[model samples]
Target: MTQTLLPATSTESSSRPVVAVTGADGFIGSHLTEELVHAGYRVRAMAIYTSQGSYGWLDHVAPEVMQHVEVQLGDVRDAGSVRALMRGAQTVYHLAALIAIPYSYVAPRSYVETNITGTLNVLEAARDLGTARVVHTSTSEVYGTARTVPIHESHPLQGQSPYSATKIGADKLAESYFLSFGLPVVTLRPFNTYGPRQSARAVIPTIISQVAAGQRVIRLGDLRPTRDFNFVADTARAFRAVGEAGPEVLGRTLNAGSGREITVGDTVKLIGQVMGADLRVEQEDIRLRPEGSEVMRLLADHSELQALTGWAPQLTLEEGLRRTATWFTDPANLARYRVGEYTI
Candidate 1:
């Protein structure tokens, strides 16, 4: 299913430290893999092992870029598979996890297993292999509905959803390893990341695909809830920046975001504006999260990242949406998505 999903090879890396990404088949992971290759590192794009041998978004990238990296099929849950992939891999990027919030409610245990266990496996492998850098992926959901505006790393975490809870567990596990064993690791907490190749299960893709596909009534859950949207390209750069930040900032968590907030209602309007229409949002009852489970708002504090590494967001929400809308509007691309349906 990931065929034409992620780009799959490398051309310009030799003798540089290899950066292995566990979920290279995923949206953010695939983009980050590409950026790592462009940054002149030997990149090992490891997708979960499956019989079909699908490469996901890696396949969407031009073959010329594809020639610049190595693709490895493996699963994060399988420790041996993960360890073997970690060999000679100087840096490890662990983005392999089931992240759908709604699905987590139905199968909370799977979230705990995959998100928590998989992370433990990554830490263990990185520890033994002595991986020089480990940049763990953390989501803004871990902060739940923020109790304060522009939530920072010191902000308290609340597991408003099972998905958030599991991620919190995984993050805590990462922190423990860093503190106890001194693993050269940094955690990046990215706010709402939106871009091409994102699954429809996410709000941005769900809304953009539907609107771009000419849907008059764009279905959505809560419009009042706001999020700090970060373009995927910028978020990918954050991963590289975290790794290059080194030990002084080691064991620290940085927020990769635009530091700007937009309500879902306003975001829908923005998408409509990009699509050249003022589409109406219809509340899809089924699309709504459980009353108490939904995160009402999320605004990120990105100051630490800038002060620490001089890394800042480059794309505005409007620019990112225009690009994302353009991609989803392409017939060849739109056909890749089930735009007309409510994606659970």
Candidate 2:
């Protein structure tokens, strides 16, 4: 009953093992799906099912790329659904979760259900299906306010917020599967990934949308905090690299980022420069994370990832911002977001 779009070459045998993506409708997931398709892989894209038939960002992917993708609808939290979606796939990229930090504060249980339980479902399904590889997505937020200048995979994980707490739990679950069941899983902990098609809940999209709407003041929080951001394309490529890496990387967590840190305030100024507009920033109470929950700095030490796969981020912060600003300024793309509102 599932539909797979294949190119003419696949009409002969279609022997390429299918790769399933669990959050294929999301920002990073959608990009990764497209990347996988472009790389000659048959992709089974699992968009979260909704009655309205919306495929999230997948609806915006170019039709040519869609030819190699099979868009399946399912929820990751449901083990049966996950197993069904991954039945014929050789690899799975588990990226489905409730990722908003503020929303986690409001609905901690939802974060637990989606992030923790959802990961468990993927692990169980992968193990049961004898999948060749699994790439579990992790966040830089798990390393709360860096204890070291450039955080490494060895850094102690701190759960400063509910979202990070659940993600930590999910990461531990992935590790448990690798140890207990010998599931071939690689955990990819990516720092802030920003670019077009990112939802308004994230900082980069929110700031770009607000500025593109001609707002005089940009509402932001904790300008002193810094982050290491990777462009979406680079991040997607990193996922593929991790997925295809040799057995040496099994059960290991790799960090993917630009290895460059920039403050939130400076990012605003940089976006202003990209947009060719003078920007003023205002701190909003609603935008601020709880005092102890704030992660003041995150700089990735992706030496392990680089050594393993020869992967490095391709775009500088300014270049990525320029492209993001251009996309957000387009009337068609701009219409998708409510620029005046705080999404969280």
Candidate 3:
């Protein structure tokens, strides 16, 4: 069943609870790692093993933040590695998965191996190790096309693409673990999280990077589709909120979003406004999702999260876009992106 671990806050290093995070080297994972460290938790971050010894985005975090983080090179797909990562952790924030929607179409098997199997490894390890809590990451894509406006956690899951399908599988596994074994788990479904350090695979970064690279004509897909974008910082805070909240959130799934919706076309216009650019649009067939696979709408109803954890979106779309644009416009940061190339 459930085991209660040490309290989240403590002044002494010996008293600080250890938290493990999978996929801590990627976009949201890296941000969440920094967030946990700032919240005074000792973080054991699992970065995918690579010969180059790259920690992905974790290498870019401030040295002060890195001081509190222990980067462990491992793969979530391997149960042994996942177990080692969670050995003594009080809580595990599982964010590792194959996240690129377009690539999932070409390599669906890889998504299953990494996303579905990887999640199983985390759940099994957490269950066996008696970890106090598991914060499993979910995405808005799982609630494809939003059968109703302001999608809630109860929205029917529609796997519009291979990536979403695998995430749905992972989410269900997490649910099964909580129900079958009373393993404490909370699934956090975030809608369109975007900000600095986000890769070009996401829409917000795609538009911002193109504009930052001086492209007057922005190439995008399905301008009609609308999304409820949440800033990365807000998303990171939501993870912490649920991770640290009392047992009321156990065995629950919560939505985190701005509760505001904007069409891709309008989003581009807004980013243009934020960057002080006069932009034009060029729809690209290659960039578009397959006809039936596209998720045309997603708007989040995060009221449940607010009621449970007092968490709410703090940055407006414009303010968030401004901050994202500022970071992308910086030459050093902008150089990291291949602006003209389609990343999918």
Candidate 4:
């Protein structure tokens, strides 16, 4: 059965193009929803339905922004709900997925359902409804530990973890839809995105939240892996860039990053520097990935995204870290996270 969608809250939004976003309640999705609103588009945001009526991060958005967003309670895993979300939408940004790496280890089947099957639902809905554009989300983890520095779009995909494997499957499915059905899809693969509203499961937030909670010795997993950490704002813009770009980007996979790399240890130190804390690291066995599953390095070659959409990361690592620290240090924001507890 088809689910009925709520009408736009404001009459002014009726004139704007309808852009549907799955997972608008998530970290990057919330930022992207706000970005789309700021760009004068009417947003249809899909938050996973729950009895508690929680809209995740969308519930915390400013009232003014909320006025332009229509929240639909649905799941990407359900075809009917996904089709309902996409109906009458000009563009669909598919971001819903189970993304925690450690959790993937515990429940690989959930990852398959949400990431792979959920993507299938999005593609089918878009194809059936004739949506103009579908901005499908991909992760740099598909490349695993980089075989070469500055991983490009053409770099070989290596799924070293269950999470990465599911994403790889999803990415391939997106490719097949574009090639097989001529669906207008652009895969925007973002490197490690970090900033405000990030869960403590992530390295940057983990370090920040611990230090904010007055912990001098930070507990973390292996600190030797390197990453190209893109700020959430820049990542949100990249999604819009691809979603709104012309057909030149159709069926193409693009990378979004700052083109800079920093090791986990150095990143921790940098966070300490930005927060004015002299922090120490204590490795925890539980936090460590299986020996072979750990991605030792990741650096993105985002030139293709720039050449195609003129999008480049605008924030420096230190500046982004500082901004993140500012948000995580806030009493209310810090209170949301269980500091000192290892999050999967």
Number of backbone-clashing residue pairs for each candidate, in the order shown: 17, 0, 0, 0
Report lDDT (Cα) of residue 62, candidate 2.
80
lDDT per residue (tens digit) for residues 243-304 in model 1: 88857778888998898999999998888887898798888788888888889989989999
Pairwise TM-score winner, candidates 1 and 3: 3
Shift of residue 291 alpha carbon in model 3, Å: 0.5
User: Global lDDT for candidate 3?
Assistant: 0.92
> After aligning candidate 4 to the native by TM-score, how far in Å is the CA of 257 from where it should be?
0.7
Task: Encode model 2's per-residue lDDT on 192-231: one tens digit a residue.
Answer: 9999999888888888999899985888777899999889
For residue 111, model 1's alpha carbon misses the true position, in angstroms, by 1.1
Q: What is the TM-score of each candidate against the true structure?
A: 0.95, 0.96, 0.96, 0.97
**Tens-place lDDT digits, model 4, residues 252-316:** 99999999999999998899888899989999999999999999999999999999989999989
Report the Cα lDDT for candidate 4.
0.94
Over 1-344, each residue of candidate 3 has an lDDT whose tens digit, in order, gives 11223433335544668999999999999989888877888899999999999999999988767767889999999999999999999999999998999999999999999999999999988888999999999999999998998798889999999999999999999999999999999999999999999989899999999998999999888899999999999999999999999999999999999999999999988988888899999988899999999999899999999999999998999999988999999999999999968998
Tell me the spans in candidate 1 whose CA falls farther than 4 Å from its real position.
Answer: 1-12
- Candidate 1, TM-score vs. the true structure? 0.95
Which candidate has the top score in TM-score?
Answer: 4
